[model samples]
Target chain A: MSVPVCVLGLGLIGGSLMRAARAAGRSVYGYNRSGGPVAAAQADGYDVSSDLGAVLSRAQAEGALLVVAVPMPAVNTVLQAIATTARDCPLTDVVSVKGPVADLVRDHGLDGRYVGGHPMAGTAESGWAAGFAELFRGATWVVSADEGRDPVVWAEVARLALDCGAAVVPAESQEHDDAAARISHLPHLFAETLALSGVRGGNLTLALAAGSFRDGTRVAGTSPALVDAMCEANAAALLRVLDEALETLAAARTALAAGSTSELTESGFAAHQKYLERGGRPSITGIVPGDHEWLARLRDAGRRGEALLTLPREVS
Target chain B: MSVPVCVLGLGLIGGSLMRAARAAGRSVYGYNRSGGPVAAAQADGYDVSSDLGAVLSRAQAEGALLVVAVPMPAVNTVLQAIATTARDCPLTDVVSVKGPVADLVRDHGLDGRYVGGHPMAGTAESGWAAGFAELFRGATWVVSADEGRDPVVWAEVARLALDCGAAVVPAESQEHDDAAARISHLPHLFAETLALSGVRGGNLTLALAAGSFRDGTRVAGTSPALVDAMCEANAAALLRVLDEALETLAAARTALAAGSTSELTESGFAAHQKYLERGGRPSITGIVPGDHEWLARLRDAGRRGEALLTLPREVS
Candidate 1:
């Protein structure tokens, strides 16, 4: 028989997991603090309830795996609850940031049965109503296991991610946080900073707000509270990455202000090289060498820095 | 009879203009330096050609309104060609930025016949191959005209933007540049900067790079040269906005570093208010004083920022 699954906090992530689990022929139980998401999940033909104890009891009885999908601050409280009442079941989480959540699990002494998981998939929409079975399709899901986590549990989590059509990438909690700081969190702050500036600039920007502005600000429109939580939870890492971005901006600013194309080109070349190296594994610093033609282009770009290199018209 | 429209360049913007004009039952002529686009467009049943002289003679014979949709560097050359060849025709341009292009037209003494128009719509894709009749649908197209521009020419240009499925917004050349700097050009720079950082931080950021990374970097993958040209052309305005963005980011950073939730919350609340005010007119500044409930929440947020404000669980 397929392993039973219990999903805690039946909002978007939890509700979707419940559906995907049931669709994969696994017995699933769900718990929520609020009645609405539980009701919506139930209405969608899943077994869910607002009764946390009942859900935990079901998971313990079935020896199922539990998926914690709650916000950051609430994560520790949920872990404590799981530790006290559902220690028999293995556990994984779906928080955006991993280090803090992983640390919480460690502090609660649930590391043995717990693995940290973050499915990098979401729409601008949220909640149970927004949950879809294929929401994780073709997306990357990061799974981080602390030292000595059960391999069986890790395999089960990887299986779930794959079953939901997501690519599973293994990582450590701090590694996950650092990576997300550069790629996800930093972009949010950058966009938020820009959007705020646009607002402060008044009518002119609003009038001219176009596709680029809308696209750039997409993540900024996420719940400010959530953003605050994320920044606060991952403060140190995010700030470090934010500093790097600021430094880059400063370099560009100095170059622009001084009419120094050479300085600007160094910055631009650094950026152009990285852009060409996308989808490869990212390092802490410097462009990764991949694709010979791409590297040659980077070399050429470096050689031609700031001289106003126009591409042949055929490119456009 | 409706105005005769001649679109120079015959690229995506120019081709789209021809298709949109034809769909609106207006006579359209297309001129391109490249034989390929001109031949392809002509074969596709457009009134297209490679002979600049023939295009000029035809427009002169029929008294056409000229819309130059060439790149920034090429705009002056196109304008000069039109001045010496199709001098009688009323001219407008669809370049992205205005001040430099406007200055060139002014210096060349083509201001009376030249109205600076930026039909604020484009896709990641380019060229005649990317042309679409609906490219400008529901878009805001700014017509940057000055006291030096003729009223008749300005009205006709407004009609053209409207006929292309865009709302016509009027502004001075400098105002257009400043606003585009804040909204369009600067955002591109920010996206590129962030995207490059992610790319450079490759191996370290691999597991962390997810949907947010992909979404934020979407514009970075756009033609770097086009973006660079945009930055170069609108350097002064972009530089100003970049400075403002730096200040905004510094305030946030200072708040974060200083451990001041009050300052962070204030900035965040202000950002929220601006988001709500986005897509409105260009005159309103300083959060409009209404919506007591929303204001109260923001004020409360300022006083006590919630670390985790999920959408009410019931909504999910």
Candidate 2:
């Protein structure tokens, strides 16, 4: 029989993981710091506990897999508790960023038992009430590995991701952070800025926004607390990507101001078309390259009004 | 009986207008410079003619309403032709910018018979084949009128908008341009710039761009020729709005750099929440005031973490 899985923190991600595990016919236990989430999970017909120590002890005794799905600020405290109380069980996490968590596991001498993970999926909603068993279906879940890490723990994490209906993508923690900054964090920042701009334009702008404005600013509607925490955690990486984006925007503005917008317009159209054609898959294989040569290729293709590259399908 | 309508130019907007008018049980005639759009409209069982003079003569003879639905570059030529051939018929045009078209109507001495119009609706796709009778359903069709303009013509335009299942919003030509700059043109510019930035981030950014990125940059996927024409026509107004948007973005960036992002975050969240609460309607009535007091109010609400204002429902 497969090992029992204990999920700590019964928020959206944690609750959804437990639900998926239960649906897959695996034994699952849930724990939350608050009595409300714990009671709610129990009401949902899942085994849950509010007492952290008792849950950790049960996990250790059952040789269970422990999944930490807390917000970033509470991650270290939970990790410390796990190190002391559930050291014998395999551990993994579902957090947005992996580098800091990976460092914490190494610092606590728990690297051998811990696998850093991030499921690249979410909606604007949160909390246990907003979660469902199929939240991670067809999602890409990144599993971070390093030298001296336990291969068995990594395998178990990948298996768990598959069980949750997610595709497993293995990478180093730093690689995941860089990619996350570019694709996820940077977009969130843009959405926030765009939202502010829309507000400044007053009501008419909002009324006229249509599909693009709504889509562009959708993430800005996320909780302010969550936006702050995520941005703060990855400030440096987000800044780097923001700076790059600013440069591109400035260049386009310059081209527009100079009455030579054709080049910029062509490039924008080409890249956007390519993005649609690929169905939103990453253009390169493995980790994203720092050089960004694909951008130049897109601009050239746009200028020529032809497709120059064929994007590969993402590995499921 | 309601006046028969004749639609010049059988592109997406023109074809859709013809289809909508026909669906409303109003007789319609379609005309195009090229044989292709004419033949396509005819195949759809629409009465179409390639001879512009014959169509305009018939429209004037029958006192039928004439709609000029063409791109910005071709608008003036069509206006000139209508001025000479169909001077007695009421005229309206579905162009993106209203100010220039209004000016042309005055210049052609057709102010009494002409109304400037812009329906705030479209998809990335274009052309006769992409036309649908319901394309304008629930959309806001802005009708621009000036003092001393024919009230009958304006009422007929509103009737036409209603027949297309769209709401009629009346405003001055310049007012329509200003509002369009903020809500429509500004968003399109931002989408293009964001698309360029995504291209620069390489394949990973594109792949990782889930809902927000796709939604934000959706307008960038529009046809390049159309993008160029629209931006060029509204360059001054668009640039003014862009400058305002850039200032807001700069402030947010500065806050982030100073490690004090709370203010920006709060404002973004407030605006976003308000956007959702209001169902994306403009908060104010009449012409959106030049001074944006609502933004400050949103920021204050966000800072206090309370709903301090109720957004007004949009007038249909």
Candidate 3:
């Protein structure tokens, strides 16, 4: 039988992971710190509770994979429990950043079994009702293939991602954090500034705001506390990318302030075209965890925009 | 009978205007510079042709309203034709920027009968096949109410916007340009730089890019020449707004580099909430062209997030 899955928190990401794993025909259950979401998850006939110790104890007994699915702030408390109770379980996480979680895991001496994982899926909503079985469908799940990672547990994490309908992207913790800073965290900063600038333009400007403003500022609607935590956790990588973006915009501003149009427009447009062309053009070959030189092969695949499902791999 | 509509340059905005005006039961036709789109428009039963001079002469004879619908580069040519052929026709345009068009109209000495109008609607797709009668349904159309404006021509332009199923947003030429620079042009700069930065992060970063990247870079897919022209024409106002955006981002970068979350996050989030609240909230009342102090009243209404459709106005 497939190994059972245990989720630590029943918020949007955790609850959704529980539902998605169960739908894949795996024995999945969860735990919530609040009574409300626990009752809601249990009503759906899944094993869930407000008891963290009991859940970890049961997971240890059943040899189930323990998935830490909490916000950035709560990850530390959860890690403390796993250190004493289920330290040998195949461990992974669904946090937004990988490096900090890796740090916490190492601090707790759980690094031997820990593999950093981040699924590229979520919404602004929270709690049990907001989650479903399809949150990670067709999404990319980044799993850290750091040096000395156990082949067995690496394959386990990758297999879970594939079963949950996500194609696994093998990356080192720092590399994943750097990429996330570019593609996700930097965009959040832009969205926040863009939204505030529109409002500052007064009513007419805000009224003239249509599709571009709406789409560009959509993420700014996300909770400030959530955005703050994510940015803070990934600050170092984010700072590098944020510098490049500012330099580009500053160049445009300089050219405009002079008597010329932006020098960045033509090349920026070409880059935009290249981005559109890259979508769905898979280049990864046969590669999987546990194979000789698998981490290097997987990193090469990621560079070519390949995911696990792009080619067949022997999971057994 | 209604005043017939004469549109020049049968591209996306022009072609769609021809279809939408006809659907609203106004006598409508258009002119194109090329034989291909002209034939396609003609085959679709639109009265379109390659003869700009002939169309303008006929519009002069029939006392029709002339709508100049062309890209930024082509506006000057169309305005010159209007100067000699249809100088007395009630005139307006649907170009992306208003101040530059107003300057061009004044240069042609057609300012007496001209009302600068811009319908806030379009798609990336161009040519006859991309247009439909429903393109302008429920969109906002900004009509300039500059000082010494003729009330009769103003109302006539406002009437055409109303018939196209767009609510008239009365604004001065410079005011409209300033607002547009904040909400539209600055965002284009951001999108262009953003798309380039994501691609610059190398292949793995580009591969991991998701919803935020997609939406943030969507407008970068627009034609580069077009974006350049729009930004160039409104450089002064855009310069002001660009400074504000850069200042905000630089502050963010400094804070992040110094081990802190973005100081802009909280205020930016609140501003986003206000933007959401502003949508569909109307306050304009008893205001239209030719009424005493109508321009000031409309400006005040615009500040309250109001449009012409919010209350009744006698058009005739």
Candidate 4:
């Protein structure tokens, strides 16, 4: 029998979970503190509730897997609410920077049932209105199941991510946090930094700004509170990455100051080439056969990723 | 009768100019030191020449527009060649940065028929093979026509840019350099800096790298010589922008260190919200207006831009 699924928060991630789970043939329920999202979800034919007791009752009745898709700071509050309900069913979360939330979970003693999961995909957009059923499609959904997590809970959470069309990316809690820091959190800092510099530029300079600024600083537009929570949650790892980035910038600055276009260009190009050379281990390795397929997809991702990362296309 | 065109270099930009102009109902001719690009242009059914006398003969024969598309270090050599040809044809260049080249023209007393032009577009890919006929379409072709350039020459140059589907943007030499520094040049430095920092991380950290790192450093992949020339040519402006970027980053760091999430988030969110609020600018606007029916295309471009920059959609 299929386990039911309950999505907490009803924001972008939460709403996505509810819709995708339903599409995957699971009985899905949604819980949000506000009636607006719940009402909207309900109108979309979802089993949704604003009341905590009612949500718990639905999850309990359906033997659902509880997904905490709330923001990092609010994870504890939801966990506390869940603690009172005494719902013993398996649980998981979609919080981005996981260390603090995992620590919070440990502090509250919910490790047995809760798995930390983060889908490595998002846009600057947020909310129930922004929710789509296929947001996690072909994206890496990192599931960080610590030693204390129940195997059954782990399997169910993995299945949930899979059902949502995401690759089940398994990791240790610390590993996930550190990895996110290198890739996700630190980029935000660079982006914010890049944009903040432009704020002081002349109005004409800012107006004449083109694709690069927009692409380079895309992440700076993300939620400040969330970014802060993320950075604070994963401070140690983020700082290390930041140091490396600063050093790189310093080296580049020195090179630029020296006026060697060839050397600077080669250095920059070499770094990018190195990145393409040492690429990602995709979340869905088994969806296709052989490492070649993985390479091909990674290459495709990199190519398309270029359009997203820089200008859409050259002006021709 | 129109003044003769004498394109001094037969590389990608010059070759593309010959092809695009011919296609747009204009007579075209080209000259290259090496027989290679000129040979290729001739083979591609355009009028081109390797012999200086032959190039002079063609320029005097057809009296078409001249485009000097060569590297920064090579621009003076081409100007010297132009001196030797002693042709009265109106001339312009497709150089990336124009200040030094323009200065060289004035210094060498070749500014009478010479106007500085830069087609603000190209790929990391270069060479004759990389020269597409439509490369400058929808691109901003900056024409830096100083006092010495004849008005008739300026109008013809503008007409060439228009024929090639480019917007004729006018700016002084220093203004163009400064603008390129902010829009074209600084982004490269930022990208390089980000990539260099990212690649220097520990192996474990590098393994965890994701979209943000990739996006932030995409421009780091371009040819180094080109980047170097850009940095060297626009040194003053590039330095100023770099300092500004560093300051911005330092401020952001300070905010982060002080746990000022509100300030960080406010700035970050405001940046993104402004992009969303601005609606979307057409990708092809400055490149291919007037010559095409662009309303529907512009609207679509705007929609995609909005989708890219606006709020992140919820994935369920």
Candidate 5:
């Protein structure tokens, strides 16, 4: 029989992972710190255990893969337990940030058996109730494993991502952190900043805000606790990107102050117009080109029906 | 019989006004500087003319109301011609910027019969082909008439807006400019800045830019000439709003650099969350409260049916 996959935390990411794995016909198990998620998972016909020792012992005996999908703050405690109990089980994580998680695994001397994974997919909603089997489908899942690490462990982690209907993108931890900081973290900060500015104008400004403003600040409506964790976890990388963004904004301000519309409107508008004409898809080196090929392999491996394996439509 | 409406310039705004007025069963005539838009407007069943004198003479004979729906740079030229030809014709403009148009009217000694108007609606698309009868439906159209201006003239201008299915918002020229700068122009500047930044990151950043980034920077895709004209026309007010935005962004940068996630994430998220919870509508003081009543009156006055007068759904 294929090795079972055990998910920890049972929150949005963990619960979704369990569902996705099961949908791929993999034997899946789940564990949650709270009884509520465990009971809910059980109700959903998922095999979940509240006892950590019982879950870990079964995982070790069956040589199952373990996925730690806990929040950034709770990752350390889970890591400590994993290092002591399931030392030989291949493991991965589904966290937003990778550097810190990689460091934790190294600290526990479990780096050889661990890989840092992050699925760039989620809605503003959270918790088990918000989880869905197709959350990771057609998403870009970043796998940050050390260059010299065991290829088998990396492959196993990639297999999990593929089973969830994702395209696996391999990168160093630092690279992943930097890119995430630029595209994801910094946008959240800007969204918050813009939203706060709109609020300062009282209700009239909000009333006048059209599609552009709404789209620009939609992420600002995300839960504060989650925002805090993500921003804080990737603080250094986020700060770097924010510095670049401030420079761009400052140049626009300078042009505005000087009544130089050419800078902000001429060159800026042309560049953006070009970007849009290209369908807004950025070309990533090495990875994006192989996306279709990798997806085909993944579909063949999972044996998911054609409907489940089709590429997702590009979000406009 | 109601006074016929003559539209100057057969671009998107002018063409749309002609179509919308016609849909309300108002007699309308359109004029264009070029053959292309005039032909296109004619093909769309609009009564359009290429000869300025013919259109102006017909309007004068009919005691028609004149709407200058030209670009910012072309507004003065149209005003000069109107002063020479249809000096006594009740005139208004559909320009994005009101202050300059108001000044032009005052310079031409036509303020007595002129009101500055702006419609807070548009898509990224432009030109005659982009014009539609429903373009102004449910949009906030600012009527910037001088205080103590002729009530009859103001009523005529309000009638046009109501006929087009828009809610009339009364404000001084400066107030409209300031609010437009804060809510509309400033967001475009920010969108352009962010889009330019994403371009600098190469194609990978664009590829990874998900829904939030796309929504945030959508306006950056607007035509450069249009963007340049809008920014240049309202440079003063836009500069002021840009200063405020820079300050807010700088605060976020400082917080990020200082590892103070609370400022950027906690308060920012809460404020945004509150804004969303309130349905993203900002409360405007004078015009918003009586929207329903004004709309009803407008429909009755225009003789448009209830189906045509239905309020537009608020864009979330």
Candidate 6:
């Protein structure tokens, strides 16, 4: 039988992962540090509990693949419990930023078995009740494929992502973090600033707002605490992109003052059209684990816009 | 019967105006500078032509209200035609910015019969085929109420807006320009810069983009020439808001560099929440055109988030 799945922290991503795993016919269970989601999951007839130690012990005895599904702040405690109770189980995480979580895993002496993952799917809502089995369906799930990482655990993570209905985009931790800093975190920052400036324009501005304003500022309405953690954790990469965006914006300001916004508008429109042209792309295949150049090939595929779950391999 | 409407330009905004005015049972006809949209409108059974002079002469004979629904660059030419042909017709415009259009009207010696109007609604699409009669349904239509302006023309423009299923918000041209800069132009600038930066983050970033990236960059994909003219026409107010946005973004960059984005995120989230709380507000009424303080009261009601279309008034 396939390895049993053990997910820690029953928040949106974790709870959804458990459900999707169960839907795929894998033996899946989860743990919640809080009592509410635990009781909710229990009532829903899922295997769950608030007892961290007991959950880790069960995972150890059953040889379950332990998934770190906690928020950034709670990651350390979860890692510590896993390090003490289930030290040898294969591990992965679903945190937004991979580099920081990888570093934390290293600190907790769990890096040998840990592969980082981030599924690019969410709504404005959060918490346990806001999740569904389809949250990751047809979405891109990035799997960390850093050099020198254990190949067996990498296959396990990729398999789980595919079974959860996500197309796997295998990337190195730093590459994933850097790209996310630009595409994900940077947009959150812009949304926040736009929302703030629009509101400060007073009641007339609010009354005049239409589609562009609403869509531009939509992500600013996300949970502040959640936004803060994801943005702050990838500060280095985010700062690089922020500086570039600021430079472009300042140039737009100069262009506006000089009686023409053509230069910025033209380039910006071209870039936006390029982004819009990325739909319905075909996924690449043939790369597989247990090959000498598998990691490099997988990462290259992801960079070239391919979301291929690697060819089936014998996981030792 | 309502006032006969003559629209100068059969592009999206102007064509939509002609359709909506006719749908509201007004006697509406239009002129197009180009032959393509004229033919398309004619195919749709619209009363449209490429003969600007003939259209204005017919408007003069019928004493129809004139709507200058051209882009900013074409405003002067259309106003010149009105000055030469239909100089006494009550005139208004659907251009994005108001102050510049008003100044152009004065330059063309057609200011006496002019009332600045802008329907705060449109899609990213342009040209005749992209418009429909329902484009402005339930949308805000800002009608300029500058002091010493002709009240008769203002009522004509406001009445047309109401008939097109839009709520009217009256303000001075400069006030409208200022608020438009903050709520509209600045967001466009932000979307442009953010889209440019994200695209530059390489292929992996583009592949990883989700809803936030798509929504934040949506308006950036609008027609670049249209965006440029609207933004460039309101340069003064746009520059001021752009500077303010830059200041906030610079502060966010500093916060991200300093290892905490809480300050920016918290305030931004609060601002976004405030914008969200503006739905279903009651429209303030009892402000009529013939009252002693009608102009000031209308402007006040607009600033207080009311979009009452005003009470009916007699026109001499």
Assess candidate 2 and give its lDDT.
Answer: 0.73
Best by DockQ: 6
**Residue B276 local lDDT, model 5:** 73
Question: What residue runs in model 4 are displaced by over 4 Å at the alpha carbon?
Answer: A57-64, A145-148, A192-214, A217-235, A261-264, A274-316, B53-66, B84-90, B111-113, B145-152, B196-214, B261-316
Best by TM-score: 6
How well does model 4 score by local distance difference test? 0.67
lDDT of each: 0.71, 0.73, 0.85, 0.67, 0.74, 0.87
Name the docking class for model 5: acceptable
Which 10 residues in a row give candidate 3 chain A its minimum summed lDDT? A307-316
Q: What is candidate 5's TM-score against the reference?
A: 0.86
- Which of the numbered candidates is closest to the native, going by highest lDDT? 6
Candidate 2 residue-wise lDDT, B1-316, digit = tens: 6799999998989989999989999899979999998888888899999999999999999998889898888888888888889999998999999888887888888888887778888876788999999998878777664555565676677678878887655556665676677666666766777677667656544544567677778888777788778777777676776677677667767777776567767888888876666553332233221224432433233222222111132211
List of chain B TM-scores, one per candidate: 0.84, 0.85, 0.94, 0.80, 0.84, 0.95
Ranking by DockQ: 6, 3, 5, 2, 4, 1
Deviating ranges (above 4 Å) for candidate 5: A266-316, B273-316
- Per-residue lDDT tens digits of candidate 3, residues A119-220? 999888877899998999988999887887877788878778888889887788888898998888888888999998999988888888888888888889
Q: Write the per-residue lDDT of candidate 4 for residues A218-297, one digit (tens) a residue.
A: 77777787788788767766666666666666666776778755655677688788877875543222322123343244
How close to the true structure is residue B141 of candidate 1, measured as C-alpha lDDT? 72
**Where does candidate 1 chain B have its weakest 10-residue lDDT segment?**
B302-311
DockQ of predictions, in order shown = 0.19, 0.28, 0.64, 0.23, 0.32, 0.79
State the displacement of the C-alpha of residue B112, model 4, in Å, after optimal TM-score superposition: 4.7
For all predicted structures, in order, the TM-scores are 0.74, 0.81, 0.91, 0.80, 0.86, 0.95
Q: What is the TM-score of chain A in candidate 2?
A: 0.84
Model 3 chain B lowest lDDT segment of ten: B307-316
Candidate 5 lDDT, B224-280, residue by residue in tens: 678778877888877777787778778777776776667767777877776676452
Clashing residue pairs found in predicted model 6? none
How would you order the candidates by lDDT, starting with the best?
Answer: 6, 3, 5, 2, 1, 4
Per-residue lDDT for B22-89 in model 3, tens only?
88899998798889999999999999889999999999999899998888788899888888899989
